[model samples]
Target: MTTNTEPALHKSLGTLQLWGIAVGLVISGEYFGWSFGWASAGTLGFMVTAIFIAAMYACFIFSFTELTTSIPHAGGPFEYSRRAFGPVGGYLAGFATLVEFVFAPPAISLAIGAYLNVQFPALDPKIAALGAYLVFMGLNIVGVQIAATFELFVTLVAIFELLVFMGVVSPGFSVANFVKGGWSGEDAFSLASVPGMFAAIPFAIWFFLAIEGVAMAAEEARDPKRSIPIAYIAGILTLVVLAIGVMLFAGGAGDWTQLANINDPLPQAMKLIVGDNSGWLHMLVWLGLFGLIASFHGIILGYSRQIFALSRAGYLPELLGRVHPKFRTPHLAILAGGIVGIAAIFSDELITFGGQTLTANIVTMSVFGAIVMYILSMASLFKLRATEPGLPRSFRAPGFPVVPGFALLAAVVCLVAMTYYNPLIAGVFVGLMALGYLYFLATRSRRAVRAATAV
Candidate 1:
């Protein structure tokens, strides 16, 4: 029988906060710019491309909802993989996931700097980048409550910025921009080749990536089964709908090419539609910046938990597992996150290898990492269905084999689509996962040796 002295299992995260964190990390600020750029790259119609991205995203959410409820733990995708595939597979999946988080902050922080540069030309990008990091650090250090509150605030600001920018400039819209003969010279609106669509899918996946992090919050949730699913479903659908609306409005408004070319699309859209120098639009642009800050805060919290989990499992340094008694936060993991983010900043500042710029390359790699996790995590569902039918699930994936089966198919299609779209980075992701598997083996060997010596 279980003893009363056993450690408590629940954590403090609320349902609303759970949704905010999920949405904040996945759909905030410049991510929309990335999504817009990627979706626009496809041969599909404006609405069609956006919907396709949204649909793929939905599958992930539906699939993960069941897993999160079944195994409400802090490890996120890693935890699910470990349960289904055993230790080594879990560690590798989690390791790949960790790599994505570690790389993401710097890329996002750099994006924030770029947006700030567009708005305030006098400010140095390095300073802007540092400032972004400081803000991320401050929010996370203080507490998750403040962090969640800020995320909620940013979510509102992002939504407002979208509505105002789109509404005000919508009058100038013209369907002519899209009709200028599609990118292929044959009605850009036409869906012609599978090859082109395949090429566009990776870019699209990059935009829609990171929805899986929401499911991981189940361990911290006040109500894991109820909250994870609600947050995952609501947050994703909200972002996708708002994203489509923003895209449609911008495309129709006027001069889609100018907005696309602009380093920061939202601010550029505002400038073009409302006549650039308008103070209100500039202020609104900053508000959009607020969204990025919010997203960063949520991501750091989620990523740290992943780290904390890995460390507990003996895969990472034990120092990472320590939690601050005072703040009740993973202080060491948070610090590690900050350090990695700083390194990322410095690396980004220096690197300009290959034909693509540093930021572009990171974006490509980040997308690849995310898609790998998605494909693997979705595959886990089938494994769980067969191996662990006895496991209790709080929230079930609707339609059983049908819904999950379709999700599995969608994930495979996305993988194929990503590979065809940018084979270089897709290859890199495979290499990275292989390296993770190797690392796991090495760690296991070291542990076994240590145990033998002790015995």
Candidate 2:
């Protein structure tokens, strides 16, 4: 196993490229997952839910930037928690990050399959999904610069497509369409809709799900101290605007119920505006693939770093951390994540007790992971602020204790809310974490014994 850490990755990313990395990590999110919120809460309720979630993320990102710049490590939340709370905390943080970064790609990969099928009706979506995994993983393994440059290109395309979507749908956007009958077909908001609004939190979170992933790339950044703040602030602004715009337009474009649970909400929304065979629908569907591709390729890059950092620190098998001799990338880790994602795509038809699709179940499980990481990371930030008072921070979170506290509280609420709404999905996630922690325990003791014996 190659454990050398002196030169693990090429240091070539700048502010613009980092912006690409951050934006690309989550642009696909704006296209699909958030609409699932509408299924439970309807358009207006989901919109209200989205606004709160967006505020939580805004606070989270500001706090996370301080952690990234102060530590400047590829381990992200893992590194931050390890410093503040020790080994067990590190494992939980790392495992949550792995779940967040690794599982997200499968969801995006499935969307890629759905988007491709729009153009090629004969192609099997399963094959297309697996094909997306193989192709993007290969690109990431080649080199970070190439992968990042490609990310920038596709992100720009995705951004332009969003602008075009908003323009095309704006003429047809009626506030009445978005708000009227938007409360799950009920006359008005009631006590019963409270659970639904909470249930919608996870889907609303999808709008900016992995943008904090920029922190994972800090170790490879040319000037993470300065660039990190710029990347994060700019990245969140981009997403917030995009999220609100897309959600409002998508909801207002048609019979909001038709879009609540689908994989490709944008194309469907456009079809409603322009009819079944509009030339606009065909163009948007093709360009929309860029949005999905941006997130897929960027996340593979982020998860590889998460894997590399953990394995190198002995949290996982050292071989999984091995850097490619020529490419200087975590090739094994990339392939491992890819294999698991391909497996998920194949098993995408499973159902939860709530009759949610495997994709919905997986989405809930991934949100659980994000919630865990957010709570820990925010706590780490609060702890570090008190303990490491003079840690030479380049960027400080805006409201200090208040901001991190709000983020922590918001994350805790989301965690409890989602678990209450989706008990089966919650149980499955807890079981998975238990299995991983067991592996960690066995390996940690074995390593200690080996060290003592060597003496």
Tell me the tens digit of each residue's lDDT in model 1 across 94-143.
Answer: 87688767667766777678778877889876678778777777667676
TM-score of each: 0.89, 0.96
Scanning candidate 2 in windows of ten residues, the lowest lDDT window is 1-10
Model 2 lDDT on a 0 to 1 scale:
0.87
- Evaluated against the true structure, the overall lDDT of model 1 is 0.67
Most lDDT-accurate candidate: 2
Query: Clash pairs of candidate 1?
Result: 173-252, 173-253, 182-188, 199-421
What's the TM for model 2? 0.96
Local accuracy of candidate 2 as per-residue lDDT tens digits, 1-455: 13233337778889999999999999999888888888888887888898899899999999999999999888999999988998789899999999888888888888888888887889887788888898999999999999999999999999999999999999999988898777766658887777778889989888888898888889889999999899998999999999999988988897888887788889999988898788898888889999999999999999889998888677888788788999989999999888877777777445334778666766777788899999999999989988999998989999978988899999999999998998888887888889999988978975465335552
Error of 1 at 180 (Å): 2.9
Query: How much lDDT does each candidate structure score?
Result: 0.67, 0.87
